[model samples]
Target: MSKKKIKADSTIGLTLKTMVISPIALAYLVYSIFQSQIQSFDSISTSLLLIDSGIVTALQLLLFTKSAKKVSLTMLGILQYISPTISLIGGVFLYHEVLTNAHFIAFVFIWCALAVYTISSITKWRQEQMKNEINMEA
Candidate 1:
C-alpha cells in the first residue's frame, strides 16, 4: 500500500482509539478523584497535572501505535527498553547519580538477557521461514 494511505489509516486508527478510550479513562479519573487522595492538590495544580499527564499519555500512545504498525513485533518488544535505558543514562551522566555495583550488575544481566532473547527469536523466525519455503517448493 502507499505510504500516504498507511499514514492516513494510522492517524484514523489513533483518533478512533482515543475517542473510544477517553470516556472510560475519564470515568476512571473521576473515580480516582473521589476514591483516591486527589484532594491533596489544590484545584489549579491538579487540573494542570491532569492535563499534562493526559497529553503525555496521548502522545506516547500515538507514537507507540504508529511505530508498532511499522516494525516487527520482536523489534517493538526490544524498543520497550528505550525508556529505562534513557533513565539509566540520565541518572549516571546527567544527574550524576551513583550507579551502585548491584545496579550495574542488574543492568548488565538485563541487557544480556535481552540479547539472548533477541537472538533466539530471530533464529526461530528464520527456521520458520525456511520451513515455509521448503513446503512451498514441495
Candidate 2:
C-alpha cells in the first residue's frame, strides 16, 4: 500500500480505540458515582452532585468522541483540556474559588495553544479546499 494509505490506516486504528474507550470510561464513571453514593460517603444532596457529574461526563465524552474521530489525538487532548480549564475559570471567577496567578497563567497557555491549533487547521483546510477546486478546474 501507499504511504498515505498506511498513515490513514494508523489514524483509523487510533479512532477505533478512542471510540471504544470513551463509552467505557463514561460508564465506569457513572458506576463509581453510584457506588460512592451507596457507600454513604454523602447524603441525597451530595449524591445528586455525583449523579449530575456522571451524566455530564457521559454527555461530554459522547460529544468529544465524535470530534476526536475527525481530529488527531493531540488536538483532541487539548480540546478536552480546555473544557475543564474553562470550568475551573468559571468556578474561580463566578464562585470565587480563590483564583491564583499560576492557575490563570496555565489556562492562558492552554488557550494560546488551542488558538494556534485552530488557526493552523483553518488555514490548512482552506488551502486544501482551494487546491481541490484548482484540480477540478484543471
What is each predicted model's overall lDDT from 0 to 1? Answer: 0.82, 0.71
Tens digit per residue, CA lDDT, model 1, 60-125: 877766767778666777888989999999999999999999999999999999999989998998
Tell me the deviation in Å of residue 91 in model 2: 1.6
Q: How many backbone clashes does candidate 1 have?
A: 0
Model 2 spans > 4 angstroms off: 1-75
On a 0 to 100 scale, what is the lDDT of residue 45 in model 2? 78
State the lDDT of candidate 2 residue by residue for 1-138, as single tens digits. Answer: 322234344445556766888899779768987777445445787778877986786666556545555676556566667669778978988988986899778878878978898899889989999999999999
* Range of the 10 consecutive residues with the lowest summed lDDT in candidate 2: 1-10
Q: Candidate 2: what lDDT?
A: 0.71
**Which ranges of candidate 1 are over 4 A from the true structure?**
1-54, 65-73
Error at 19, model 1, angstroms: 12
